[model samples]
Target: MLNIQSGSTEFWRAWNHLLRPVSSRVETPRVKLSRRWKVLAVAAAAVLGVGGLPTAGAASAAGASPVHIRFSTGGATPPNEMEAAIFSPELQKKGILKGYDKDYTLSILTASKGTPQTLSLLAADQIDIGTLGFSTIALGQAKHAIKGGFSVVVAQFVDAHPGYGANAYMVLKNSGISGPADLKGKVIGTNQLGSASDIVLRAWLVNHKLDPRKDVQFVESGYATQQAALNSGRVALGTFVQPFEAMEQASGKAKILFTTAEATGETAAIAVVARNNFLKEHPKAVKSFLADWVAGLQWLAKPENRTEAIAIMSRITGTPTNVLGLVYGVKGKDYYRDLKGCPSAKALQNGIDAMVKVGDLKTRVDVSKLIDASYLPYPC
Candidate 1:
């Protein structure tokens, strides 16, 4: 159950928006998860990829409720890297994560919304840990207004390519729009108004000498609806991430514009974070979770486990095996961070600066101080 707290009204609005069931018809891409949680002997999982892992407190002798970390998936794919492993028979065999969940639980504990929502929950102590975007955290800090009560645990994911996010942009086939120049006076859609999609798109435009704010009409189009918006002619261009990006390109109905990698060399995924007090109070439990998560990453990253890994991801996202393999890079060399949980510091700092220069974020955040890497899977 969610115990929402006070925070920026902008975030509250987004929080409420994320609380809807999958069919809510919201403009945002964060669709709700299945409300019915499978009883895993542990706890319940929330709607739309809003799942939680129980902490060490779940041990019977301790007689305390488990630490509930409500995590969210913030991309176009099945946010199931760890979920695939944690809930699978592999992790089940080790029994390393079993202390918390008789069964893994899903929670709608306000962490599903976005950075602001996650921060608010952290500040209020409503949830212990959740997934967040580094850019969001950095931009919020730069503005010097985000609620302060959490520390970064690990880097969530990453995408590296010559022009991944930028080149991943999709325009309807035969739309007559060839490049960034065509979008100068037209509406271009992003998953969120101030997220990776928005910032990356703007940065790509700026690189082309187009002032995103002045030259184009930037609109908020949820990731789920981005494709529809394009087909319906609601927006001239729709930005996508991951499978959504790969899916659109595969559909042959759209064409790539350019590579967004030009702006930020690589795309960093969401991060795992926890309330400062909770992290300090129970370091072992946190480490166990990270260790288990990293173990999962390591298993799936290996070539031998490729088949099961694909099946696991397919089951988690309900995406097909073929699509998962293609977009997620099961066969290809799409390296996921194993023991190394944090992204390149330089890349993240540059991302923060890009957001600031584009006015997406008003302040400059010191990326160095924002992370508490001491608790990560490896030494920082």
Candidate 2:
């Protein structure tokens, strides 16, 4: 469960508008592979039934009409319901595939990724479609894993701070902490190590001259555990996105400390990914999915649907309407688009660089290898 809050002040509003995403190249940690090793790997993988491998044509042809699929998503509710409401109907109406009503099994994949559990469940031929942060997808690609293609949803406006600042840092109102600097020496909570929120938050701390690892200890908490950690007085601050932050504040359980919108003007937090095998075999199905999904995104952006979208999201996530509303307002235009408006290349590269500086990434990663702009929903 996440905490949500009411409306924000004008300063918070103005701050969000100022910190937009920008493009500036910075040296990021890369995987240590000589050019020869890299070429050899690509070549070997190409010949060894890995890279450029095609999907099973017979299976795809067997299930042409409303193909059965298992689309995986994350835990956050607003994005979940918003995506569901938009995509499910559009997919069915467009004669694509079945998911929302019953044609497919939509699995909610937890954010935990490690030794065995990874987003590459697609490469392993487990799930057919899923969603992941662009940064996560990029990391997977650089590792020579996760054979998938992506469809970007550009998030145009981020009401919170920028440069990974899209997440909120909250404190209990009674804790007497009001600003970022006040968090010195306090215990803070993030989803986990290697999480986007963790990386960005650490960068914010570093910019402020605070040693995230030393000055403020970070604890790993899942979506459900984060709220519990904060309520138990075990954590002075907890990080979360949108509706959760608003809901917590509205309930008087927490206070707004700061948000990524307040730091960076642009931010992108979500993306839809299709497995390479499925995408290759069912090209038409994949295209249909993107078309419907784009329609869904457009519908969700409408002012008339805003309230209903928020309610649907609240119902799914168990967040309050007021809190959801606040979160929605802050997100602005980017709520409907892809990374161009939200998680720009500059911001993502910053994340890569931050992770490298913290020694989380083993080697330098070329940011370009992770993104595939060839799949943008427009210019079709």
Candidate 3:
């Protein structure tokens, strides 16, 4: 379980500042690869069998109309309730894990790239629910990028102080990189441009007294393509979450330069996002979905459930059990992963404040607007 401490004064200051009017919107800049790199992205995505969000919807099967909730594993990682319940037979007995719901059927989407693609799908009304990076959705909401009123449903994994958990940036083992100072003028690759990986990397740079805007360049690649790009010498450094993060390190090909926690304490969390209209349009269906979601989290939080949990996630994601265990997240220890589907306001605020300080977000958002807790009727 994560220690959901209150936000620091800096966070409140930033939040309050957002209450005031800003003269202009200062958008964080991202490195755009050339047309050649675009082709590379296509080829890499094809090789991985991943692409933009899926457009799969289902009609009523028997009696109750099926509510389709589309969600993706961020960067095709993080074994959240959506992926776990689909594979875990024990969780299936609880409800959603069985992969068949009386009221809801999941259309699990694959995100070849990162937040932008998923956010676009959400804005276009393509996906009813999305598993998105913490800052991605917050900044998107700040810009009114989402089409309707959207709220965070749960936390997938959260940013914590260094060493508390894993969300790391790695460089090829032989790549002459030691620390943040070494990254100046080098190309740092991450999944999404404006997502947690980007924000934390920039924060890490600034904290080390290097100017992220001038000192280094960011290479954008999808999670699936991240490893290929890193090993192929396309990017000097790469940032990854969960399975992929461990996968790279295990290959003996890369070593950890830093983690998000190391640079900026406890930033970058993942959550389920849903538009208010969808919640209202299908209240009962959404309620049941939330129920299943919580049940999945509960199943994961138990220590004895680890073996089955790993097997289920491995089957669903094709990631080995060793890599998948990190998502289960131990209780009251140095290690923690996943929010068990619930995240706190303070943790989310900490990430937003980091972005605001970094100028990644032009205006501070009313965070309350991004959360709708109605779906979870009781405390998990």
Candidate 4:
């Protein structure tokens, strides 16, 4: 099971260990090229910013080797957790993920800091694909923080769409904090300062005429620990995503104060992004991966697969089946995912604009230009 307790040093250590490459894990040998020529070729490609070089797909077609793709996820939740299905041998056996070991191999890395950490990894060339939030996309584009930049290739999940579940802000049922007005001079817990949830929280607060910087104190806490922090009076409000939200609501100890949808209507909370160089160099492999991704989603959406889908998520996230069943794949109780793997440019643009209005972003970004929908399984 994936451990998402990001506040723990041990978790970071384990995560970093997983990021290191192991020679034995290489799926195939490189093409027969001298070391000096290979180094020169790489240097020339880097200097020229060219994309016509042999890619994983081209090499694999020539019976060489499949491409290795390192993808990042924030935690064990939809659609982050659901992405594990793309790597499941069971799914591959059933032909749900038809391209798993053919066109590309996948390594799903956990980035607890969410988009910021993912962006850093992209800049460092440590990750090939990352699930990033709208605010992070804006920040990266505006600052040009990543080499070759990145493009939104597919949708991870959409928050607060009609008939879909939205992330919640919860407080103890009897805490007497009825609304945002009562949060003044109180501490609120967040997963991270610039995370999607945190951005929404800040926007909500600003919309309510409260200054998040001066009216309330912010404390960093993982979603796993927010319930305890709230119950112990360490924080008056705790931001929650599923299955933590479902678990907390089931406990009957907390009540929902507001939801992210109420603050920003129908936002693209997260999307799958890839570095520009990777997209340009491995277009065929990226498209094949996306095809399998859409296929996986289709397989999970089957009514007959509900039980097994829940079980798969349960096993991956270490959450009980019953807890995950509360919202996993349930219409109106889970985040919305595009079956075709196309992300909503309009929603992302709105989210970025909201961040600027809330002072969370210094500059605005044209999200449409940063999105590459041509690689999706179908038209956007």
Candidate 5:
């Protein structure tokens, strides 16, 4: 019976095409019915053999195979404005990456959950793709825990207030501190060992001719803890990003001491990484996801989209819209070219070398190969 029905459908379709007049198109009832029914039939078939549809450009490369991408990112909060609305949504549509439990299940993981968590997730194969801090990625590679797949978000060097930017140094307003040199014999704080703030602070200290080991004391602290520490006089100074620095000043606890850009004279930051085996196994899906992800960034970077983009980033990061707008810079001009080095290779290698020189790393690791720029759109 099913075969007979199918045969009849095909016969009618063919007959409809034959009877259709050429050079004299007419939307007669019969022609309309035929076209409508044909569309219905195709739709029905698509539901049954959904895999038969032509995948979009990127997906087309892999044929009809359903590629599963486990994606991750860093930062305590979800992607800022442009990312949630434009970036993540477009990528998830590929079905290669999907949201499970409000969290993306794409083989991607990020360092936002903290360095240790990121490493553990990758080591257990729970996450395949992740946005990682450059320092974290290098350290993980050294320990043989994970490797690079593609570079995602890059760090922009901004001299905005500390705590707003990721690598900021803070000091109390009344500490009588004027510059990096004033911090000598004073206490500074960061989240933990191997953090961006930790590494950048050391670099900053060395840049000012102070020894990180002796001239300054490194105190382990958190956002809330750092604010509290500064308030209670636990530490004379600290290093962190904005809002925290802004908040400290707002609350009359601390002031923006220095931004990483001031110390390094260049933008130094982090990137996304993939586990070795994961990258090898699912290279196609990786490329597709990135192509669309970069598209979203480009779209959001447009001048017309700036207002909405800032609102979105503010919503996600919980940073005030006013503050977010001021802090988040223009895309191509302020931020790194999409998927290109936010923290350029030269800067990252320099940072790593600085770390090694300060005895932060046992061996100087080569990071050039670690940055997979192929995932980004050409001319990035």
Candidate 6:
């Protein structure tokens, strides 16, 4: 069993700092590709100083240095922090993750502020792989913040696919707010200003003929804190995903007003994106990572592994096992994840178009240019 207290206090403090919202007024400076690549090469050299650098083909040789990959994830569930659980030592010992500590080693970065922060990290070359939402992919491309643009390699999770769990918008059961119109003048809580849930909330309000800007107020509250925000009447409505949603519903004090699916159809809410240069320089390692990722998902999906999987998630996230058991890895109860690591281009495009329709984005992005599924284990 994994120990929940294994993480150091300093690590958690840094993680919490990363989770805090980035100020809109502060601009994230973008580094040129050449400079970024030079920095990475220097860092690699520093690590392999004594042995000298080995060629890509020699990566898996005995005593060869492993490729260092920094991966950024947002939350502690299927779409986000699954990599952490999947790559845990326990799972690796069970052979669920075959690539770890082989040709590549992973450093998981927490982007609790969501894709926007991930975008910043990617632009600065702080993270090699990022779990990005459709909106951020489009935004990054439009702004040229991501050097060669986002090269999506795998699907993280799909939101509101058929019977799968969707992000929920909740309110106190006795709050008497039944519909969008009832939300007028009320304070709504969102994980972040441009997060997927926030975009869906705005779109839903517009569909109901209410102007999101004028009809309601939005407060930036973390997902972990949203339940308390709702209970204390700090915010009349709050957006929830996974385990948090399950916890709130089980309490019988909150009720779902609507879901992401109700606002917009199925969405490619999160997908694994790699820096173009990283994909080009480490194709073999990339392939190994994807293969392991698919294998991990398959292992977690098996009924026999359900209990162990829940325990792993609870340890990583500090969520109760019962709460995680309620939704984690349970088909139709958890978000839909593709076993082969193929994300739906159509779903991603639809999500981008929805953002444009809501006036959140000024233009539509060509989904084709943003995705490079050639690195996936299977065809996208």
Question: How well does each candidate superpose onto the true structure, as a TM-score?
Answer: 0.75, 0.68, 0.75, 0.84, 0.66, 0.83
lDDT of each: 0.58, 0.52, 0.63, 0.77, 0.53, 0.75
Where does candidate 1 stray beyond 4 Å?
1-66, 79-114, 143-148, 161-167, 330-339
Off by over 4 Å in 6: 1-63, 76-81
lDDT of 1 by residue, 261-316 (tens): 65666655456666676677667667766666666666666678777777876665
- State which candidate, 5 or 6, has the greater TM-score: 6
Which residues of candidate 3, in runs, are more than 4 Å off?
1-64, 80-100, 161-163, 323-340
Where model 2 places Cα greater than 4 Å from the true spot, the runs are: 1-64, 88-120, 147-165, 178-184, 261-265, 329-347, 362-369, 373-377
**Residue 288 lDDT (model 2):** 54
Candidates sorted on lDDT, descending: 4, 6, 3, 1, 5, 2
Tell me how far the alpha carbon of residue 73 in candidate 1 is from the true structure, in angstroms, after superposition: 3.8
Q: Name the 10 consecutive residues with the lowest summed lDDT in model 5.
A: 1-10
lDDT of 4 by residue, 1-380 (tens): 12223434544433333333545225444345555544444433322222344322344457665776667776445534467755566587787777777878766666666678877777777667888878888888888988988899888778898899988999999999998899999999998888778889999999999998899999988777788898899999999888889889888999999998888888887788889988887887899889988888888878899888878777766778898888887888888888888889987887888898788787788899988988877897
Candidate 4, residue 172: Cα displacement in angstroms equals 0.7
As a whole number from 0 to 100, the lDDT of residue 321 in candidate 6 is 90
TM-score of 1: 0.75
Between candidates 2 and 4, name the one with more favorable lDDT.
4
True-vs-predicted CA distance for residue 192, candidate 1, Å: 0.7
Q: Say which prediction, candidate 1 or candidate 5, comes out ahead on lDDT.
A: 1
lDDT tens readout by residue for model 5, 1-380: 01012224454454344334543334544443465566544442332222243211223245535454444444433222122534544334544233221222232222333455556556655555655555676677678764443333333332322333444567777789888778888877776667555677777778788888888777776543577787677788765554454445556556677766666544345455666665566566666555555565565567786787667666555667665554455332133333332335665666666667567789887777666666454544
lDDT of 6 by residue, 310-359 (tens): 88878776788987888876667788878888878887887888889799
Steric collisions counted per model: 21, 48, 4, 0, 23, 0
RMSD of each: 7.6, 14.6, 11.9, 8.3, 18.0, 7.7
Task: List pairs with backbone clashes in candidate 3.
Answer: 85-97, 92-98, 159-266, 160-266
